[model samples]
Target: MPTEVLHRLSTLSLTSVKQLGRLPRLSSSLPALPAPRPTLAASEVPTLFREPHILSGYRPAGQPWSSYLLSTFQWHNESMNVWTHLLAAPLLLLRCWSLLEGAGGPWRLLGDVAALPLVLYVVSALTYLACSVAAHLLQSRSELTHYSVFFLDYVGVAVYQYGCALGHYFYGSEPRWRDDILGGLMGAVYLPSAALLAWMSCACCCFAKAHYRRPYPPRRKVVQLIPTGLAYVLDISPVAHRLLVAGDWQRDDDGALGFHAAQVVFFMMAAMFFSYPFPECCLPGHCDIIGHAHQLFHFFLALCTVCQLEALFRDFLARRAAILDVHGGELVVGAGVSFFVLVLCCLATAVWMRRTVQKRLKDQQA
Candidate 1:
């Protein structure tokens, strides 16, 4: 009887050990607890949502980086803003690659004096759009992140403008000025303009309280328009000179002038939407999800960019022989050096702005 009891006890102990082993496996197979969503403050989101009827899907500040990134898959106010440019960046890059690889009129002319600057312009556009994507995506993470991302976005715009000016200097017209003079003039005009835009963007992000209070305050609109106006002036001056002074309008392709006109129109529309915040201002909450002015602004800006590229390509095709024959190696080198220097300055400014934001945050916390 005692032996039988001991044997039974041993069997029971063995079964208990097996059950314990199975318990861990069961636990391992169980789903993990979902991470908590960040709690957002009212001010963290766009001011338009301040109206009770408008639902602002505001993500909380101080979210984990992984959480913010994962938020891309979720629906929010910024979802369209983030995805529009994010998806467009790759498409634009593919288009650029196709243009570079295809053998044809403008593609063949790519080896000419304007090739490098044109390439730079394409790269700058990609960079600007990519930065916009990043800024919109991660701006919700924290105030520091918001300020830093905005500064970077501004820098991206400045870089693209610099490239635009470089391309215009190199290829927009027949080389009337000496290569050195052209290079010097471009650097003088665009470098200061770029610097000013960057500074203004940083100031807008850092010190412009009106931006947070409303979408389109007159003061804020003026501040924003200043950069866009400066960019237009810089970009269009060469086109005007080509048409008016160089008499290149006669050689333009059938649709080139129309495309240029469309480009200007689109840019103006973007500015108007950006500055006025129309339709949404009128309808308020009704258009919150689908049809906001800022979204329209983005779409128009993209169209403007496409038109600009088309115009540039048309000009390139028309002036291929002259561009190839021109000996402007020194001008090309100067533009390249200036581009690098501008990029470095932008980086330094971004870092400085980031530090300033961080320090301010720390002070507030203290």
Candidate 2:
């Protein structure tokens, strides 16, 4: 057979070794391989790895007091909310310092004359700090926590208002407790009245929590106290009016508060302004926006600060004009503390109002 024909026949027959087979040339082609991966050892793994399910990690409820306090700085809704008021405590301390330094020489002699007002200020600051932190942290924890913290917040407010009244009483000549006939009787009514309101609010909150097995609403008590506190604040206007009758100046056993009815009246009005829980009056969602009841309360509180300052200035001037000699430093300190507190309360009110409004609006849209 011809060579080509033989080659074809051999290739086709699968017997090409003799007729058509030839050695093959090899190329660089090879099988693919995977890249090497790094391995992790049990010891090399982080402690967090042992608990794989704890991606977020469950934090126990009974966190330490210091931990809870430090937690305010972390990523929580109340982080900013909590610190805002906590900052006020230090600011008040600073005010106390400034007040001491600014007070004239004659004022320093009275030992702890400011004890009541100062104590009130401290309690108010502490109560607010606790309320702010507790409300911020616990309100979201559980239903019980929510109600407890909320009641505490109201109690803080009541204490703050009562402190304002107490501060004013310090400037007056009458002892908070005088058993001298009309003086004693007045003290009996006024002092106990304020105390009773505070106690009732606290009691109601406690009773509601314990007996009702629910969050007690302090709204009714607040409603009752609003008018009563306002009346008490207004009733003191007679004193202010009496001061006015004595001309633009009058002297008390201690010093002189400005006798101008305008100034005194302004101060009295501020107290009345703070007496009401304006936060409750807001039409649910509306005030939650830019002008909530809390904000209004803050504004009134701020106004009280300004008014008190004005009253203080008037008092100082009157004292200067009268050439009277008495230490009024405590009163000044009390006022300064109140002013700082007023600013803090105002800021809190603003923030809360913003949150409330945002929440309401989102709810509506949803």
Candidate 3:
């Protein structure tokens, strides 16, 4: 009692001492407890802009710009859609560089015929892919952002389609004014149609907000197909005319015609997937993060671009004799000017779209 009582009295009775004694236990217990996992704020997690069955599986709705960006690293419906094109852009760009470098040097003749058209072809493909990446990634940012980016995406498609038409017109035929006149006539017919389709798509997106919701309306589906149908008409008419004039489908010595055929097939497949929304429609939610129709559409579109490039290369080789006879300097200048004009037009349209969208957003907010 004497020793125990003395020890107890010697021990501090202060609140600080009691708190100090508990500190080690609290520290030890913390290590045993699981760490707090990072979580998104409810508002940070996006909601679906479309119906569940339409996309299937889980889809993010609206989110802020930062979260929309960060979402790229996470699994979501648009993940594959974004990545398929994002990854393709660099690969296509590298292919463009390799093709351009190879066309130069001792093969200057090849460069003369192929260089500008090839460059334009790859650049146009890259533009579409890059725009697709932006549109898919930022779709959840806001309604304004979604519509704006998608408008740009449609414009990108129009630009690429026009580039394809121009490439065929420039390099597909012999370098003659008759061909040039023909090309100009074709472009005059198709380019304005493409532009109108693009405008129509933007208008549809802006005005028909309700069209995107639910059961995929028949009218909306038809309206959406109009631009694609126009693209098909523009892309196919010249090729069809060429084949008709050539009058020998079986004798494609360079396989350029065959490649064009394959390109059309791939383009059709892409369009089919885009319009149908296949296996996703059948299974519903099973392929949301991975094998959806939209992703398939992206894949097919990339393949179509590849086929187009191959066709361009083959056509260049086939026309080498004619191309060699022409004044290389003049041809180069003409092609350069054309490419510059195309780029300027695309950029101008983009700026106009951005300004229009911003104005509309401001008006809405006000």
Best by TM-score: 1
Better of 1 and 3 by lDDT: 1
Please estimate how well model 2 matches the true structure, expressed as its whole-model Cα lDDT: 0.41
What pairs collide in candidate 2? Answer: 258-315
Model 3: per-residue Cα lDDT over 58-127, one tens digit each: 3344444666666555556676777667766765665555655675633564444435655666667888
After aligning candidate 1 to the native by TM-score, how far in Å is the CA of 330 from where it should be?
A: 0.7
For model 2, the run of ten residues with the poorest summed lDDT: 26-35
Top candidate on lDDT is 1
Cα-lDDT of candidate 1? 0.62
Deviating ranges (above 4 Å) for candidate 2? 1-84, 104-122, 129-133, 173-184, 204-291, 299-366
Candidate 3 accuracy as lDDT:
0.60
Q: Which sections of candidate 1 miss by over 4 Å?
A: 1-55, 104-113, 174-217, 242-249, 324-327
Q: Is candidate 2 or candidate 3 better by TM-score?
A: 3
lDDT of 2 by residue, 225-327 (tens): 5544554453343334336343424344322343223334444444554454344353433332233333333333333333343333333333332221232
Q: Provide TM-scores for the models.
A: 0.75, 0.44, 0.69
Residue-level lDDT of model 1, residues 253-296, one tens digit each, is 44455556666777889888767667777786666555677777
lDDT against the true structure, each candidate? 0.62, 0.41, 0.60
- Residue 311's lDDT within candidate 2 is 38
Candidate 1 Cα deviation (angstroms), residue 315: 2.3
What TM-score number comes out for model 3? 0.69
**Residue 181, candidate 2: C-alpha displacement in angstroms:** 11
